[model samples]
Target: MLEDFERGRVSAFFRRVADSIPVSDRPASLVITHLLAERPKFLEGVARLSDVAAVLPKPRSIDEGALRQVKAAMQVDELNRDRFADPEQATAYVESRAAGRSLGLLDVGGYFAPALEHLHTHFSGRILGVVEDTENGHQRYEELDKLHVPVFSVARSPLKDPEDYLVGQSVVFSTEALVRSRDDILNGRPACVIGYGKIGRSVAAMLHAKHVGVTVYDTDHVRRVQAMSQGFRTAATLSEALAGAGFVVCATGNFALREDDFARVANGAYIASVTSSDDELELSALNSMYARTPTEPHVVRYSRTGHYFYILADGNAVNFIHGASVGPFILLVQAEILAALALLASGQYGPGMWEVPAEVRQSIAATWLTYFHGVS
Candidate 1:
């Protein structure tokens, strides 16, 4: 099934051949440009169409729900290099580029862009203009000369204002979506959280902050040690952690849990995944034994990222999937995404595989809501 998926999905050719392409005059657009709002790597089966042809990759933020569908459909793997291996160093690199410059702000839609613009405009410091649109072209701007926009790293956090905004509507949206999925684990009073990687660790921290038990679990002993040092349980194996756990959140990048793994899990052991790859956890195995759509129903989804089931958006990056509310932070995310797009196309970030920017994911969600869902 996995190989067929790889062949049927990932291996499909994307570029239109000369024989396949309809003849046209005036330099026909052989380039099939795709504006992706969610993580592009998840949609695995179209490169053949663009192979040997120009592929202009544009990023847009999309609905978290849609993001998951895209990932499952793509059958992606984590072969791409992580851009932020040393997050601090990556962030510092961005800062270095803008030593004494102001980050130029561009508001593409009525979401994060506006909030960020509002901050730059009304806040104490000098801020560049807030555009109603960026469709019209501009060679460059003055604000990017300043270092306001942190557009270089994996911006997964929320916007911070002078007064508490609850992360505001956006933060509320994220928390509620996450809570709904793992509510059972909370009810069970989990013994520990089995998180996969940095993202899983982040969620574990969030759960820990709420006094919920969190345990770092992955094939990586280093991650386990890191979690233990943080003063949490460290289990060498899945059984050790699941022995008394109320729930589990799998963030590991692999989805190879066979039927036996599920059997070992305690009955009604709640679980969720927040990784970029949706295939990491054996959702199919869990579905065979436990809840179904009839038994469980999806409540309102928060901005497409936060919904039930330890919410995961398009199996891309969890933070991006869960983040759909108005976060001024997304503004920087958009910029970094634009930077990434630039890198991919211009060969600055030579590519085999890569993820679309979180901001683009949100934007694409909104766009699809309009194009496919008939909403504006």
Candidate 2:
């Protein structure tokens, strides 16, 4: 019943955002993304309303159909996948790419803040704007709030309401995966969720709904209080959270978990990452501690302590792992991306980091409700 309601709400919300995009033809855009097959279709559709000069591919091991389509449309600045691992190279590449182009930047990870800063420093006038689609990226962009370039983000969209519904659906997908992995049903097992952000809160809610005992830990007192208000256990320290938890979900985007965390975890506790970044689980530190690499898909058994903990998607985004069925949620965000680019091209918005305008947001919600979901 909850899922049904969320689906209707998200679809309606997405349609309204789509409606807010000006009907006038949009200008050329440069899209930098972690290429996914579905993403290209949406990008291509949006381009018909606007011109796109290039689609820069960030290397993730996805099948190449969508990537080929993107290449067919325009030049693909093929950066080596290794560049993403090094901040210096990645930032440098972005600066080089953005040099002297007044094109709109449709950015995925939002790691291009340095490049944006560089463009500002060099006085190349201004690009159309920047659009970011990830929480980590949005947070990074907020740090540069003083920049003159017009910045917009779907990752920070009010429609998805990251703190509640959107994160709620994502956690539902992940919990389903976590439960299916075990032969025994997960009911009543203690689960520790780090970070009381949107993702963490949703994860805890779902786990608790499934009759799993949940403990939440966050550095912020307010978040901890929020967790407590929901009637879940609250941990004062990391050690306390991991002490007896049979399942641990690291939703914090920051590097919070480590060898010390593993040592503190219950011997057989499963540690999974809900955040997209590899550093969320600190796999490199874990690998250094282990003599051999994890051979199985998304499963890592430590060599030193012979401690076994399964990593969903090899510590990548557990929700987006193969067959998670969260594509609908991703599409909702994609719709906002298209609208964001259209807004940027319309020249209606000005320089400065800002939220997606409320009118645009409402338009998206109205479109989805009326046309897509038949909510009229």
Best-matching candidate per lDDT: 2
Q: What TM-score number comes out for model 2?
A: 0.81
Worst 10 residues of 1 by lDDT: 25-34
Worst 10 residues of 2 by lDDT: 320-329
Q: What is the C-alpha lDDT profile of model 2 across 24-106, one tens digit per residue? A: 64466667776765555566555655566667765543437767766777678764536644556654554465544456778
Total colliding residue pairs, candidate 2: 9
Model 2 pairs in collision: 12-368, 12-369, 15-364, 15-368, 16-363, 16-364, 16-365, 16-368, 17-364
Q: What is the C-alpha lDDT of each candidate?
A: 0.37, 0.66
Q: Which stretches of candidate 2 lie over 4 Å from their true place?
A: 1-20, 23-26, 34-37, 57-65, 68-100, 123-125, 162-185, 292-296, 306-308, 327-329
Candidate 1 lDDT for residue 265: 55
Task: Residues 242-327, candidate 1: write the lDDT tens digits.
Answer: 66565556554455244456555554444444332333455544444444432233222211112223323322333334443332
Give per-model TM-scores.
0.42, 0.81
